[model samples]
Target: MGKGAILGSAALALVSAARSARTVATWRTVRPLPEAPLDKGKVSVVIPVRDEESTIDGCLASLRTQRHSDLEIVVVDDASTDRTVEIVRQHVAEDPRVRLVRTDGPPPGWAGKVHAMYRGVAETSGEWLLFVDSDTESAPDLVGKLVAAAARDDADLITTPGRATVPNSGWWLLLAPTNVLLFDTASPDGSRGKAVGIGHCILVSRAAYDRTGGWRALSGEHADDVAFATAVRDAGGRTRLVDGMDSITSSGLDSFGAVWRSQRKSMVAGGAMVGGPAAGAAALGLGGLLHIAYGVAPVLMSLRGNGFVRLAGLAAWAAQAAAHRTYMVASHQSGATAVLAPVANATFGAQMLDAAWRSVRGGNLWKGRDIR
Candidate 1:
């Protein structure tokens, strides 16, 4: 090989090594909080429900069996047209711990979920606030573990990655990996110096919530969890991510169309918050293209019989996949999926492009609302 080729390879290797070191540092710095056995402080579980009739029953049923006896359940019905309210009311009637609150509309500049969450928090009296989704089913000890984790780590906020129950469809196998990839890239467990948190199952101390100005502070933010965590961290509060896969399962996302629409809406909404539609779209487009190019280069190099180029490409791809798989398995994904990690990474890259283009054209829609 020429000296110029060797120098280029050496530079690439150095960059790769630096990225790996950063990922390792992230994992070591942010360890999972230890599990709490029971709710030591008064705990309130808040669930914001919309048209979740299909899964609300199972979610409430699971909550009813929670081992945290001292906890209260607050369900905010966000003007659903389905039987979601009825199901929640039934659960409320059966157990005094569960209360139902109704909201007619989201206030200006506030997303529906954040508006509902504010109402739920206002109606509950607990030292700890747990914001859970209506489409999620929790294990009996889920609340206890979250509370325990919070206390053990002195975390101001705690979030978990739940199992994504994708429907049995080819689209799901192809696109579902984007969610995992996002978590891997943005989460502290996967990358260093990256702010990370998921909204599905977030636990915040009442003090921390109040100090950060609660949901009202994040009222205008589309990615409320990320905004809230950033606020906490900026205020010198600690946040931790926990493994909630076995403790909670999500309703199966059954349609490819639904996944694409949902993701597009989310990207647009989040993008809008960071920048206007134009800048956000451009950022997503550029990032997506780079990711896809990197992912496909290895295959192209190998096919061309360029051993040096192929080796470099393969190493880069493997490093990226390994980092992603580490985050997935740590979050409780099955090892079987790890074997398909490269495929997942590539799919994620493709989805980013689709989402960005859809967002720019104002094609993003969700829950009967056009986020863009």
Candidate 2:
């Protein structure tokens, strides 16, 4: 048994345990907002659509069946060259509560989604506004529950994380924990206490939104959710991040390319939090440690060591695997995906390097627009 292998195994095990504890401590599960009726305030759901024809109907259907009665759905079409407009129009015709608006295009310096949300907000009037992605399908009580939770906590903004649905591929599972970690760090409990709003389903009071400068304030940022949360927190507004797995699910990934593109975009945008390229490089080094220590080191030790070293390596690997499994289950992913932890860690390491490269190069393309 080599001294180095034993030391490495101990360190890796400790890291895995610490990460698992942090995830558990930071995880915020969503409960039903309240048991009250919908007489509190008028709620407006602002959905930004862009070539989401396939998923638009289901999303609209979810909104239509909301338990909350005083709700208006505003769908902002970002010049979709598809049936997105047609689908939204159909909903508008059938249900008076749904309205469709179009955006000419995002002006220079404005990200597409942020621009669409800004336009949607302009066309709708509601005491409470919910910005939901077009691909997300909400449960009937989602809006009511979120509104009630915000009111109970006296929170100005509430962001809910959705369950990821990747029916075709398991590789996409790797990206799930990235969000869990991000959500943990982005919430008030992280080092910065900066509450980052998850874009899939974010609910905010109109007054609190205006206090943080609203969509206009996040116009130039590539990652509007995090930027918006930072703004809200800066303005002394209470920001809450909750679990939306029961209330909403996002099935946007149909291919590995989709997974890659989404992960790349997030990594690039997330670099803004730590100081751009330099921070990304530093993070890459740190991310590499997980794969090397937990995945590669085990294999090397088992092959090279005599007895105790091999056992230590195996134990560390098991610890990491268990920690990863717990995280997957907590994040509403299939627990079976934990068996693929090594692959996930390797992919993450590669993605971190790729993200650093993209950050150094300025920005990447998202939804056919450059995010810089």
Per lDDT, the best of the predicted structures is 2
Error of 2 at 107 (Å): 1.5
Q: Write the per-residue lDDT of candidate 1 for residues 231-281, one digit (tens) a residue.
A: 777666778777667688776444666556556666777776667778887
TM value for model 2? 0.85
Tens digits of per-residue lDDT for model 2, 1-372:
568767866776566566655555565343434655344788999998888989999999988999887999999988898889988889999999999999977888777888999999998889999999877898888888888878777788888767766543434345544644564456542236567677888888899889988788878677778778778878877887766677788877546667677777777766655675677656755765554445666566556756777776666556556656766666566667665565566666676666667666764357665554
Q: Which candidate achieves the best TM-score against the true structure?
A: 1
> After best superposition, candidate 2 residue 346: deviation in angstroms?
1.3
Task: List where candidate 2 sits over 4 angstroms from the true fold.
Answer: 1-7, 28-39, 165-172, 188-192, 254-256, 272-294, 302-312, 357-364
What shift in Å separates residue 129 of candidate 2 from its native position after superposition? 0.8
